[model samples]
Target: MPRFTVFMGLLAMTDDFVILVVDDNANNRFALRVLLSRLPETEVIEAAAGEEALMHTVTRDIHLILLDIQMPGMDGFETARHLLMTERTRNIPIIFLTAVFKAKEFIERGFAIGAVDYLTKPLEDNLLLSRVRFYQVLHARENRLADVVRQLRRQERSLSIALSQAEAANRTKSIFLANMSHELRTPLNAIIGFSEVVARSATIGPEDRKNLEIIYRSGNHLLALINEILDFSKIEAGRVEVVDEATDLGLLLDEVIKLLLPRAEQAGLTLLAQVETIPAVVRVDATKLRQVLLNLLGNAIKFTRQGSVVLEVRGDPATEGAVRIEFAVRDTGIGIALADQRRIFEPFTQIVTHAIGAGTGLGLAITQRYLSMMGAELTVESTLGEGSVFRFTLVAQLATEAVEVPASKGAVIGLAEADRGKRILIVDDDPDARRLLVQILAPLGFALAEAVDGMDAIARTASFCPQLILMDWRMPELDGLAAMQQIRAEQGEKAPPILMCTANVLGEQRSEAIAAGSSGFLVKPVRRDELFAALEEQLGLCFQRESTEQQKAAAVVISPTDLVAEIATLSDEIRDALRKAAEELNTSEVGALLARVADDHPHLARHIAAMLEEFQFEELIALLHA
Candidate 1:
């Protein structure tokens, strides 16, 4: 509601009181004025009729109204009712003066019309003076009360305006922080992505490779700091979101350890993790839980210079598959002082230690905040000389399905690489991000197309018809959400899978991309393997970067007898359908046939898809005969 100002008209007076005397007869008005003047410090306002009396109330301050009962146009009773109706004149006491109406009924009627007192024609001058004085005293009290009320309302309106401005400023700050997150993360993604690609180059010399590794690590650390700021802002604003799904907790721990192992080794710290003997699969927010563990483990490893950093997970199972799991990280480096434990959790609070890595102090604070949202807390125990231990517990329900954790990719023996020239689109406003994506995918023998922003992505998508798209979430003209919606609406079935990449890993953004029909959402800086994994999953591309074109050509060649012998392990019924589909050149049906055992036999799926795309029906003889 908008603020409102109300001007109230109540009887106001100084030491000298002003009275309104209304009468049609000039003689009666004179008599009432002369009689009212008997009261000390008094001034009489004369009105010939009720309308004139109302005008006097509006123009001048009238303490009390002395209305004559016998009037030509508006009588005294009617005039008293009018005086009681208006806010300006309502609070003024009315005294009716008349020679008649002394009967019980007329006297009651006079008081019923809001008259404070009534007097007959032969009124005593002394009594009239005392009544007017009593009314003036009562009017003074009402004015004082109304003054206080008006003051309170003014203060209330001021507070309301200030509160509105504060809320608006907070909203503006939130928008700035959100935009700042996007602006910083866009280029940070490119830096981390490109540095990692260079670090993994086999052709680089030892010294150069070492420098590249340093660059890669530094970029990653920078990305982490940026993430910490964004996360802290979200948490502070109460916008943190948690998404729960079925995940293998054991594998999650292993991946975190794998990620930190290199850094731990570089620092000469022994890093190890152990998952207790319990059910591996559980329903939880795997992303948040992994983040918590990563922070704790990374901190433990970073702070431990010469000694070991160990991560341990233990599950205390209960009835109905409910388990209380405790995750702890222990280190043997320089321990924190007891007084500093609390301060270290505050943002930007750096511990004085001999460790090399300098981290944004938000890691522990964010971890604790995340845990608190999940109904948990972080507990720490540290001595002055020895290392420290940090732990937390979470409740989870065990998953019924057996978890099939993927083993390491291992050596690519006999892994036939897919045909080259698979077109992939990279969409971002930042040129560095686009160039970095090209660097990551070009060596894998894929054709690359670039779009500057969301608007550019929409314009080029239909014609380029890329098999995959890595779209940045924040863009200038059109954001990822709007562009994705438009592309899906226009292209429908032909729109290629879009994997949105953003620096923000908030669940709301993830949910938005999913709602907009995005195929995947990846937070930057994206890892090289994870990026390829998404491509392989979405496009069914077999990644064997070392496989030459000469080898792929030789593998698809066919001979009638040799082909039948090659797939002798195949069943008869599936064999007939494969040959029929290959003959009719139904690529989708061929893909469906290949899907039957693709999970178990990715090599055969890649082989069959390749032959089907090449239209080499002779090669299908072996697939059919299998």
Candidate 2:
């Protein structure tokens, strides 16, 4: 009973234990049932014959069986044989009872039939009850083990489902970010590109040019915000990798300063660069370094309202041609509280009381992650209401002479004489986008043609026979990748070098463009210099340059006040059409409408045409509204 105690508790909590008694003699069955009744939570089913025993085993959850030999029809050996032959009742323990004295023969035959024990004539009640109790304990353990296995299987299924759902959610987030980036950059391309074109105009007055600069800077600021979010996503997905290359530390630092100089000026904060000692060139991930520096300096400028923000660098030559460079961004403004210093590096965390401007709060987190990937740690020191310094150190190899940074090139005025008149095709769905490229390349003395979509571009490619093709990635009817594949299949090596110029800024999109036979990739909001650079690389074209005086003399100055007056004199119908076209930023339609006004006033048409060439839709819209 002591050995049975543990199992009895387990069996009481579960299903009842069933015992089947198979004996032709009713009295024998009754005797076995009375003996089995002593066991707790046990039920006994009586069977008068072997057939009845088989039925009871199929219908009941039998744990053990008692069979009597020397019965009327089926003997105990035959009943045991029948029970052992079936799959369901095979594991049920059987004890045989017989009224024979042939111990040697009867016991051997009964044991051979899978009986647990053989009892003679008059069975001992205590011995029978003990065997039943032992079987009951074994049955209870088997049931508990099966339940545990079932529960484990259920948990495994739940975990698998959760993992699948998480994977799906991640995929959805990635797609959403990519699409949002493209949608944002599409219009920003026009905003930044047109502003840049206007800012470079020598005809615009100094004050007008300054306002244009503000617009240009603001457009770039929005673009940077978009990039910050996308970059954080890339880091979280583990898609970011450090690509080391020859980088000019001085030039890189200069570029960052130039980019942030206007913001510092607008904020009335003094920005300084203190370089103690640095190499001419170092091997590192220039893009990541630029991003980290930009984040640090940008934050410094943002938090500092009245004081100065300084970027200090010190480089010392280290072992194996490596230079240990330490960078520090120090700002005199409202400093971080001691309690919130560590939390600043965490994603989307901001000290509301100390913050001075709006931000995604991921800048420092991303900066720290980028530094960690480059095998460096970012540290901060700050005093409340005083100032703060964020610093990091990295060891980079000195670049060889072969890795020298090329000097910045001057502005490209036109193509070289030899490369002039080369056929160039521009494809885009947006009319303003196509006009922007036309305005840039057409004036460069190249033969430029426009296509509204990928299919149109393919048709023009064969008819116009362009030597270079600038194709947008997304479009209706067909996409850039599919169109490029078709052209490559049709023309083979005869296909022109296709530059994928689109708003898609994702890394995979760039890879896809190259794999689809694109000669190069250029993101939207492309600068005049970047477009020229891409053109030069692909077509091997040398661009003609003009000095400041020469460009100024060639420029035409148009006064917006006079343009609005000239528009007022035009017919109401023509004026309305012009305003609508300007609102839509449809440069082609506006050009056509302006042609109607050319006959009336050549001077007014010329000025308006100049604005259209510069993609000054905003100015035109304002003038038309006035």
Candidate 3:
């Protein structure tokens, strides 16, 4: 009895443990309550009828129930049946009490209705207390169990959130790694490839010119890749501030197409555009918009094989004469599967099966992010082995007049013409680089002097008294920074404008250059246009040709008809050789044989050469047939 009383106290100590007593008569309910009331902190809810008992069980934690067999409306058996049917009260152990000892069948009926046990009305106090104590212990266990379940649920939720955050972190890290690989590999490719070309070239031969050309193209590609990567990182970090201005979307698209035409033609893919009659000018971040469009078009060209890559611009006439610009790039290439579609947009995620070469895989990812920044959604439709079409829309205000928007910083800058025949100094440790710079600048009407190192550059600055100095930023002895400082200290403000020519695109590199008395920075493997732009900026030098870059671009677009004409006039032996070359996919043989076909087919030769380079043998054979 002492142990039973202690158990009862333990149950009451739980405080939330509850028991229900139901009887039609007050005396019966009072007797049940009196027994339960002995337990400290235990709650006993009394009901004179089955309905009141059900209400108490529903609203409270009724762990145990004591019922009267005969109630006024719903009898104890019916009540027990109802309790088993309800979730809250179903698990509560019920004991039925009767005025008389029930027959076997009557007792069996009580058990069938989910009554835990039966007790006569003239009950033994000890027996009743023992049964109550047993169920009380069970009720306390269930309460503790429920509390544990709730705690586990909370932990599960916390774990779910942590896992999600970790997954997102992994994705970000993957992007950073992929970009770093690209940034490092692209330049390395050029440096190594060019170094090989130069190292192998002891004497000028037939291959020497081709080697030099390869080196030039590789370096240019490396420079472009580095600049793009730097731009992507800066913009992703929100470091590159955006300037919104009027932009000609049509013109921008045209520039992108022109830029990629060489690549497209090389792949033997037709590049086409469709511009619906609508306003083309709009106000946006011109540089970012251009970058986005360029990236998408570039990806389309990169992935596509033979069919046409089309850029379509269809704008709706919006309110107040504004425009909703829609841009789409469609290509015939290896399309994405449903399972990999979303994964491909994630940075560094590439479909390895469709991969033609090494890539950073950041193109579409960067495009998607740029769209999001501009509050646009990127949509894609693709089928395996078919093609893909990527699209986005922007709400743009129509430009009322022409606006001259300067390109983003670190890009080529142009200036008005200043005094010609200005003495300029070129400095670099490498003889090839100095020769290259001389070859680039000597033809520009500038009196040029060369320096092999920083010390030489400083000496030349004093002796030559140059108007501008193009110094290498990363020389071996007395680097550009120190040399510039020394020159500035000697010549004071009258010192020539020192422009750094280096591959470094870091922000601090430019900052340090300026702090050390440098005028501006020019990225390495400097194209002729970029060199002119830098000179114009510092020396006010206007280029001779107004459409210089355009001229260069026009050289890239060869007439297909001219190529057909050239193929038509080929001799029988040369034609057979060309066909054999096409079948074997030998670009060199095809070019060499075509060189003698027609003297006026220079551009067509280049086109065929490009196709041959890209291994578009099918197209090449077709062209020879034409």
| Best of the two (2, 3) by lDDT | 2
- All candidates' TM-scores? 0.59, 0.66, 0.58
Question: CA lDDT of each candidate?
Answer: 0.76, 0.82, 0.73
Which pairs clash (backbone N, Cα, C closer than 3 Å) in model 1? Answer: 570-626
- For model 2, the stretches where C-alpha displacement exceeds 4 angstroms are 1-14, 17-53, 62-179, 233-286, 306-330, 338-355, 368-381, 389-407, 544-626
Q: Taking the candidates one at a time, how many backbone clashes does each contain? A: 1, 0, 2
Q: Is candidate 1 or candidate 3 better by TM-score?
A: 1
For 408-467, candidate 1 gives per-residue lDDT tens digits of 552222223554788898998888888888887787678899998889999889779988
| Residue 195 Cα positional deviation in candidate 1, in Å, after optimal superposition | 3.6
Which ranges in model 3 have alpha carbons more than 4 Å from their true place? 1-211, 224-238, 277-280, 318-323, 352-355, 397-401, 405-421, 429-431, 443-445, 451-459, 476-478, 482-492, 511-517, 543-606, 617-626
- Model 2 scores what on Cα lDDT? 0.82
TM-score of model 2 (CA atoms): 0.66
Task: State the lDDT of candidate 2 residue by residue for 1-626, as single tens digits.
Answer: 68578555434532789888878878888878888888889888898988788776665668888777777776777777887888987888887777777776988887887888777768888887887788889889988999999999999899899979977887887889878987999899988888887777779995587567667867887898888899999899777899999888898999999888755644445777999789988899999999999999988877764568999999986668999999999998679999999799988887854324567789999999999999899999999878899999998988885555675555687877888899889988988899888877887899999988879988998999989899998899888888888888889999999999998887888998998889999898877777888888988888987776776676454443454566789989998998899788787888798778888877777666655643545446655666
